[model samples]
Target: MPISSPRPPPLLMNLSLRSADRVSYCADMASKLAMDKRLDDFVMILESNGSDLSVLVGLLDARMVSAGICGLICEGRVGEVVRVFRLVEGLGIGAFELCDELVKAVLGLELRRLVEEGELGEVEVEVEVRRVRERLKRQVVRSVEHGGVEPTAGFIRR
Candidate 1:
């Protein structure tokens, strides 16, 4: 279970991240801390609201929604993950949102044990280091407007 740094720490500035980038950066940092098994470090940063924010932007609101949630997943806090996920899902901040990343993180953190114990087959865990680009073909257009995201099962519980 090894993952390398994909998006490196941002260069220093007064406020390096804005909008959803802030949360995305923090979540990436949380993933790194989780990979390194550094719970204390991440908790301290969260407690202080990005106090030791990966040596980038040390202090800011930073949203940190993703970091807090990712930390819970890494720490095996399943109940809290669902609780928090439902809350953040309604926020509607366009960029760096959790819809896709949540799926990947959950798969990464939860499936490792099954794979290691020989219950599940090998999966693509080395996603951070693999960066392949492909050229695109000619464009095609189709318009089938649909509802936004289908509400998760969590919404039904309401």
Candidate 2:
């Protein structure tokens, strides 16, 4: 019989599992850290006594989304990511507050990959960059139309 190569795992399956694991792990860690810092303070103030794992999990999920969004915003560029983060800090978006650190980490990894591949200026990547920029523009317009402006870099009159 002729020898044959084994099939590799599907890309979708690999991505789905990896993303799920990362989100779950990050959320759990963030919740635990938050509780450690706030437990005594909450008790002193007579607030809720115990932490809710469900809520923490939800926050983590939110963090994952925020990180993804920020990654898209910067087109996976490291310098751009840092600039956007500083802009985000200035804008004071509540969403940014929760995921700023996570977003920076994700963007940093993506940027490193781009550098390693030596394909930062490739046409395909440029398409992706343009798509992200369009989405951001739409989001900004929608926010303005809805009378709710998300705090972002360049949102304020300088």
Candidate 1 Cα RMSD (Å): 18.1
Error of 1 at 66 (Å): 3.5
Residues 1-158 of candidate 1: C-alpha lDDT, one tens digit per residue? 88976775544531566735655566556545533435445444344433343333333223454455555666655444443333333333232343347645664667676567764432232221221211111111111123333334123453
Give the lDDT of residue 50 in candidate 2: 23
List, residue by residue over 1-158, the lDDT tens digit for candidate 2. 99998766764444455544644544554444433433222122222212433333354544444544554545544444344344334333343454547665666667668768986556346656766887889888888778787547456686
> What TM-scores do the predictions have?
0.25, 0.25
lDDT of the structure predicted as candidate 1: 0.43
Which regions of candidate 1 deviate over 4 angstroms? 1-64, 92-103, 111-158
